[model samples]
Target: MITGLRYLNHSDALFTGKVPHQLGSLTNLQYLDLSWHYNRPPYRNVDNIDWLSNLSSLQYLDMSGINLTKVDIFNAITKLSSLSVLHLSNCNLKSIPVVLPYVNLTYLSTIDISENDVSSMIPNWLLGMHNLVSYNGISTDISKLIRDLSGCARYSLQRLKFHNNLLHGKLPDGLAMFSNLTELHAYNNFLSGCIPESIGSLSSSLMYLYLANNRLEDPIPEAVGELSELVVLDLSFNPLGGLISNSHFAKMTKLEAIFLSSSSVTVNMSSDWTPHFQLKNIRMGSCVLGPEFPTWLKAQRNKCLMQAFQLLYLTGFGTYLLKLST
Candidate 1:
């Protein structure tokens, strides 16, 4: 009969031992956070979380850093149809649940399962989450994960990060299907293939894009110029080649930082072409920027005013102002 409870957070407290099963009595609980701030000894881990199945009204649950290595986590949380946010990062989970399509997860929006032992291909049910907005699945095989995302809820997705994973194969053209996506972070993986031209489809909303340390090749797509809202872009340490001129950055008026180091690409902007945006940091190590110091940089001296420049082996590039004007 007790159904009025709402908030509960035991995070960072030095509480020890298994979570009490009696907590299931809070049938009306909406938010529950029993996450430990730091890792506890194996013997002190919560032996089970099956009690969570009884919290049918639960909307948010965070059990991060609480060792659930042996628990059947999916079975415990799948019934939480009201859940909107779930955080289980660093929980030592060995695998993600293979939820059936019949399961209800319509209201789920954010899911953070980073720093776990999830080695299998991402479950299919995850891609069908129509309301999903942000997803963080580091160190997993993300090749299939990206492909499946194109099936449904593509419009609701915003931030998608799968850094340091076993992701291989080309950056799928299907990624452009996510019109609402703002941040795309898939760095430090085995991903290969050229940056797809369809990426221009996200020109209206995308802001942060990080595809560094991969095996990507071919010329930078000229369609990138359509992304006028881009603030940060990193394509460094890949095998990308060909000339990247001012046309590629023509409409990126919001660009603040750029990294293009250790690649075969060349930045060949016209000497007098004035950039529309003001960049705070620019890294172009091992990149060919000049036969003559491009006069365009001189425009930055008066307008954008660089704060940090990491240029190596460039004959004409030199330091400028220490900070950008506000």
Candidate 2:
């Protein structure tokens, strides 16, 4: 009556060949983990996961780094009605089943399918899972993914990470619907267009927002300063150009890290205006923050990163280890 089974704890121990079919016989197993070390090798192959249908009580399943190339993954897990969390990252999944007859996984909340070969739009049933709280890594149409998630899990979803997916599209205004979102990571994609002004609607809840290394070319919305709870804000390496003023950070009292390097954006705050939050790290390389060096830099007693030209403006700024970017 083993209720939990966790494998791959010892790095030297490698389970080769197929996943033990006997695992499905653990009818009372609530948790089963057979994730392998991704950096080593993926040898635990599962040509057929139909065996999983026997574990009706399975609530948590992690088969990451396993070769699931021959299995219809979505169809294999649909019957696990009690499933709450599922991790199948880097499983070499070749295709994703787009439609399911019905989804019995009413309690399913978190799923990570990152680093897979499934280059398709997210399945409708996956988005329709109202109880889903966090989703990570999947290649999909950015616009449709946002629209579907906003339509289905608007209030339930909290964390979303889909960076480095080569996704192209504007972040739709529909993103503003996820009021409960605390972290949104969509960096390193091919995304274009301006960040929607409606994103300010998540002011009370969003804590981490990363959108760096994209092709966005518009000025950041002044409404972004409305993110009162935001702890980190990154909008670097884009072609964005705009005059950023104090009003753009009027309510971000919780922000601790800000990254805007390699952008055309300019910071034009008043000489005497003090930031509401003290940053631990601030990067502004290739940005325009000059003329008379704003006195606000004196209060930011942390590591400062900027271009070599801006260093000439620093006279009496104390406690700043300047890291000049070439």
Residue-wise C-alpha lDDT for candidate 1, range 1-326, written one tens digit per residue: 44577887777777777877788888889999888766445323667677888999999999888779767777677899999999988888888866663567789999998888876566777877888899887544455576677676588999998887767888888888888999999898888888999888899999999999999997899988888899999998999889998989888899888888788787889776899987777776777766655666655644443322333333455442332233
Model 1: number of backbone collisions:
0
What is each predicted model's overall lDDT from 0 to 1?
Answer: 0.79, 0.81
Listed per model in order, the count of residue pairs whose N, CA or C atoms clash below 3 Å is: 0, 0
TM-scores, one per candidate: 0.84, 0.87
Clashing pairs in 2: none
C-alpha-based local distance difference test score of model 1: 0.79
Candidate 2 lDDT over 241-276, as tens digits, reads 988898889898988888888898888888879998
Candidate 2: worst-modelled 10 consecutive residues by lDDT: 317-326
Off by over 4 Å in 1: 1-5, 13-17, 22-28, 36-44, 100-102, 138-143, 291-293, 301-319, 322-326
Specify the highest-lDDT model's number.
Answer: 2
